[model samples]
Target: MTLSRRPAHRDVPETAPVAGPIRVDPRTKNLTKRLTAGDIAVINHEDLDQVSAQALVACRPSAVVNAAASISGAYPNLGPQILLEAGIPLLDRAGEALMTQVTEGVDGSVVGNEVVVDGVVLAEGTRLDMPTVLEAMEAARGNVSQQISSFARNTMEYVKNEQDLLLDGIDLPELRTPMEGRYALVVVRGYHYKEDLQTLRPFIREAKPVLIGVDGGADALVELGYRPDLIVGDMDSVSDATLVSGAEVVVHAYRDGRAPGLDRVESLGVEDPIVLAATGTSEDVAMLLADGLGCELIVAVGTHATLIEFLDKGRQGMASTFLTRLRVGGKLVDAKGVSLLYRSRISGAALVWLLIAGLLAVVAALAATPGGRTLYQVLAVRWDDFWAFVGGIFG
Candidate 1:
């Protein structure tokens, strides 16, 4: 669900030009963390995937200027279509020079089809509309067969290299938080994660699953008022505040034992953070960590939100994700599926219990009042007299 993918509502008109301070980043995920409403995003992403696209949409950027082709026709990438649907104008293939020429935090404008910086026109690019995106998607679909072949080969290659994940699980850090035979919810800040997590509030409450946040996903849990028990990732995106929020941190290190995320967490005063050196994406490691630790049910939020997205992320990391899913498939349920199958609605048994509790409360309150004692005496006298009259008639 790279749900790193998304859909959002925007107030700006599609045809109108947008202006604001520009934010520059080659990494879309990092850019999202700092983006403010109305800021123009200057990115170097090529064949922009759904996850990165959705992230940009969430920041409510005025416009996105890509230094590379947003749709290279390599695959039917969903990013451009989502941006246009949200009414955020996309200036595609503005060229690599755009990254060097424009400085961050400078005033910029997306006028007509060109980028204007301080009244100087830096570059013009293809303004993607819905029709154009649709055409590109259709054409890209034709190349899926070729991509499928390449994807399989790449996945097998990784499966050989990272076989340790399958045959023998990597050594997981000892934890104070219990995950054994319990439901574990792993959150990623991807595709409709906010909406999906909102819907799963009931499940979270009743199940009381161990909350695991993967990198930036920890911020999402905090936003929803759920403190994460274990935070896992390269430590690039999770906030300093969240890192120090008493949750045990697991720094995802390279197989070679280099952990860049460790210094940041330690500097923030997080004590005794465990380092798990593993190959593959942080999200993959997060899933394996839960399953290997004996979690009975591992529900995923914003991680492969849907099957299409799962297939769409057919890059190098997808190979690891594929193997990790195979190992955890029995317990792994997508977050959206969990929300739909069950809701927070009260059961009949619960209603009956509530009714009984209410009646007991009323009796206790009435018995405590002085006037209630007088009423009770009168009722008792009337009950005795009425019973005597009925006994005489029966006799």
Candidate 2:
């Protein structure tokens, strides 16, 4: 699944690129939520992270025009490679001024490196194909060691500041949803989350785990027809529709007790959302909440656990995640690993089909017997008489 990191300076097709309505957003995550297939995605995300790239690819856009560098060489980001590999056209570093030139839902086409509107070129930048993206990625990989060192330093500093999480169970707000002695399924809208969730369908149905969604993960659950038992996050990414979906809200605030998300929740008419002023990410808070509530087993889907994943998430450190996992211990399971090991038993539909086959075999055996012939004749006469009586009553 590794993409080749070499620039392909191949010839561009003579045919004009497909025209579509453009959707613009400075935040790639929020843009992806509204973007549909064939729409041109305009984003200002620099060093476009892998998770955001994957989200955009899933939407199947015709092209992506980034206002910032897709691969700024900050640290071998995989987003540009992912987009190029998916056969989507990418125009990199188109500049922030391009945002004002095009309105939302305005028809536009990607002509090579240029974004064309009604036969006029609005903006043009580097046209990234496979070879170019791959070459950039290869160069970026060399800087990964430096990034790792910085990440480690950040993690250590964070641990020093937030030691209470590791030693003592920090005081947390009370949750209305009970999680004790039950399986808590925490979902995040991160890497390969949609596929992982689909794979865990049987486990979700049978175990009936308490569904706890972190921010936009709540919207993901609702999209898949599962009601979230509890929704915890900073509240910036989640839609108002999800806030009103009856899930108990827990707003993650700053260590100094400033809750930016609290105002948004209040504006949405969500009354008395439990405001948790924590130092770490909302994901960390969710895990700690589950662990504190005495969940028997915690299954996590779409969570960022790896060093690269954290880096991709724009997180400088993973202090809280490391401590949270230590606290949860062996009780925690990754949804992808669970999917590989779990063997689905016979479904109800299969059992019904088997039952029908067995009944047919029995009927064939009975038909071959003389006593069965007499029984069939009696039943047939009774059936005809019943039908005649019903018909006569209707007449």
Instruction: Specify the highest-TM-score model's number.
Output: 1
Tens-digit lDDT string for candidate 2 (176-264): 88888999999988888877888888888888899999998898888899889999999888889999999999998888989998989
Tens-digit lDDT string for candidate 1 (188-304)? 877777788889998999899999999988999999898999999989888899999999899999988999999998889898999999888888888989998999999999887
Residue 40, model 1, lDDT = 96
Which RMSD does model 2 reach against the true structure?
A: 8.0
Residue 86 alpha-carbon offset, candidate 1, angstroms: 1.3
Cα lDDT listed for each candidate: 0.85, 0.84
Model 1's TM-score against the true structure:
0.83
Best by lDDT: 1
What is the alpha-carbon lDDT of model 2 when measured against the actual structure? 0.84
